[model samples]
Target: MATTDSDTTTTDDTVLSMENVTAGYGNTTVLHDVNVAIEDGQIACLIGPNGSGKSTLMKSIYGFADVKAGSVHFRGQEITGRSPQANLKNGISYVLQDASVFPNTSVHENTLMGGYVFEDDEKAAQRAEVLYDEFPILGDIRQQDAGTLSGGQRRLLELARALMVDPDVMLLDEPSIGLEPRFIDDVFERIEQLNDLGTTILLVEQNAEKGLSVADRGFVLASGEIKFTGTGTELLNDEQVGRLYLGG
Candidate 1:
């Protein structure tokens, strides 16, 4: 069966979008002629096999990957090839795949580092205090070394740190990796809660079911190309998708 872009309904109120985007590392193209648009205030998840360019797509949006062709737009402006700092300043935040916390640093210090771009230490400290109040575990062990925390706690610290900047769009890469089921649930809950609080989330997740369950929309990529795009429930009920991607 043949699939077409007309099968999916991409809206005009897109907060971020890519058109004919061909991006990758130097001289190596991973994504090919990709088009994806995410609406404002939506949790969008990208799922695919390993090496299928899911991470590369996220990197392209965050300006970590080179755009060999096409354009990336944010808020109706062409922002292709923008610097990560510029993107962050424009309300885009990216959380990397690996553990991004300072291992030896205290959780409080780690959280505070998220506001490094800010010029005022006092304001940053105040923001940290507010986040600590919301996520009390970090507040309870404000002075504890980040390395001493469990995997779940470490992930939470990373998320708390990301919120310091109060970004509008957050790009998350493999947030559930190395986490147990319970921790994974906690992470997803936090993500949904953040979305409810008005943060638009675009994430690359290994757990397709969990990722799509929380997402308002879902995109499936194969061979660095978008294979399907639809509402999360629509994709969940898709026959071909379940047969191929979702262990049927």
Candidate 2:
């Protein structure tokens, strides 16, 4: 969907919008009127201190949290509190902070799970082939059980599986978690490569410097409310973000 100056969907500008959203877990409120705008093919990040509700917001968007108020609009349509399956059908995919793959399953089977939503088996196979080429490690490990792979390898497999859907918007929770320093850098590089290929990304990062570094726009959530929103460079330069989150 090509976007215009006025259109809020697809034209490479603000494809996702959350307006006055109030959502939470059972009896535990997490987000309070949280609002944000993510543009098309943009790498948008959320960074904050612990207990800031960054994960809560990500879960809400992915339909894991209960939305009590407000609306979530994607591609200019209301999707507030939609089911997880519904969100996936609408071109949204989520990769959680931890290893979300079936560790006991072979890498190929794990990846095949990603294409289960497709109706045509042949098309699914073709999609898997394309992703296998894009992520050759997955191809090599197609017969290997995911449980035996290292953390970084598993992380890569998880990402490749997410791309199996060819999602328009990808939500990532702490893609750098628990990775060795070398692999951590590689992970961020892979994320940048994805963004360069026109995949929209919404990321939650514990490493504020790295998060704000690669992102086009960054948001700060403190106490379940957005404290700041700006370009990655601007966020890195901001005194408040630097002092509080980035520890600069």
lDDT of each: 0.90, 0.85
Write the residue-wise lDDT of candidate 2 on 6-57 in tens digits. Answer: 3222334568988888889999999888778898879998988889899989
lDDT of 1 by residue, 1-248 (tens): 31434354346778989888999999999999898889999999998899999999999988899999989989889999999988987888888899989999999999999988899999999999999987998999999999999999999998998899999999999999999999999999999999999999999999999999998988899998999888888778888988888886
Q: Whose lDDT is greatest here?
A: 1
Score candidate 2 by TM-score against the native. Answer: 0.93
Candidate 2: lDDT of 155? 87
Top candidate by TM-score: 1
- In angstroms, give how far residue 206 of model 2 lies from its true place: 0.5
Once model 1 is optimally superposed onto the true structure by TM-score, how far is the C-alpha of residue 38 displaced, in angstroms? 0.6
